[model samples]
Target: MPAGEVQTDSIVRDALNCGKQVFIPYIYGASKKGTTNTNIKSMMEMVKLNSLADYESLQRDRWGIPAIDPNTFDQREHVLQTSLEKGEGLDIIFVPGVAFQIDPNSKLVKRLGHGKGYYDSFLHRYQTKFHSTGQQTSQLKVPPLYGLSLKEQYLSTDDEMEVPLETHDYLLQGLAIGDGTFHNSTS
Candidate 1:
């Protein structure tokens, strides 16, 4: 995690304390070579973390962010696995970005990640897998994605800077800044 990125400790704690199911990104197969598709080479899975103790027990990855170790954690439930079994996916996902811009009129949030397309690729995979099962769209739960940003990461509507968006990039439903401010896209 960078210095200006939104911290997840409080959010994780609150979600756990409220008895909400928590899942963290577990990236794998990143080192594979000879794959043209980046998504195929590097895959990410949202694995369930049972309790606050589980959250606390996480080991820090290269970025110093707490992450679940696949080698050690044997009984992991993937988000897709849960969705397939229970017909319910995540309700919300707090995305981290390097920069964010909100449209003044539409209120749509555009995000710029740190140049790694992990989240975008993960989302694309999720949609493809869920729809491929021939399940009803209503039955398949697609969560509203929100961006978590620090004050420095957000660009005001008045600012001239733009967050360049790619075709595969996702628009956030809302944004939560570090100062506890909420910017709802629908509003």
Candidate 2:
């Protein structure tokens, strides 16, 4: 297996083994590709976990409560909405990226994703709701947003990257390298 996948698998095993519920972003619509939760579960079973679910199910199914088919949701918006209805909050949000940068001052980080703003949009919308209700949003808490990548896919600082960020977009909490290295944000 590739080094990046090795690192991701290790971190995932650690997270799940430690009983830390993880929320992995799943792509919706026609642009989707790559391994689904089934594949993740197959891998997880290697380490003795039962199953894996999308963010929607993970949020709603606290204490191993099983959720319905996650495919019924329209998008990340639906996931967030349903989660709120279930009286649950997001704990960890695992995002995939090609590259990311850590801000020096706020210790904030941004991931350069597939050039689409799905993750960015979802976060912005949810944060707006949190702000309107005066509720503490997880986006502000610097939850671990690990980026999965292959070794050859790594980009250096000189790459002149354009990480999507709205005016109210929340930065990532930390970065997990493909080598199993977790880099925390330091302001």
Model 1 Cα lDDT, one tens digit per residue, 31-100: 5323466646676778888899999999887778999877754478887666545666677888899999
Model 2: residues with Cα > 4 Å off, grouped in runs: 1-22, 26-71, 74-79, 104-107, 137-144, 151-170
lDDT per residue for candidate 2 within 43-136, as digits (tens), equals 1100112334332234433423323334543443343455544444555666656666666566666666655656666666555654555446
Instruction: Give the CA lDDT, 0 to 100, for residue 110 in model 1.
Output: 94
TM-score of every candidate: 0.87, 0.53
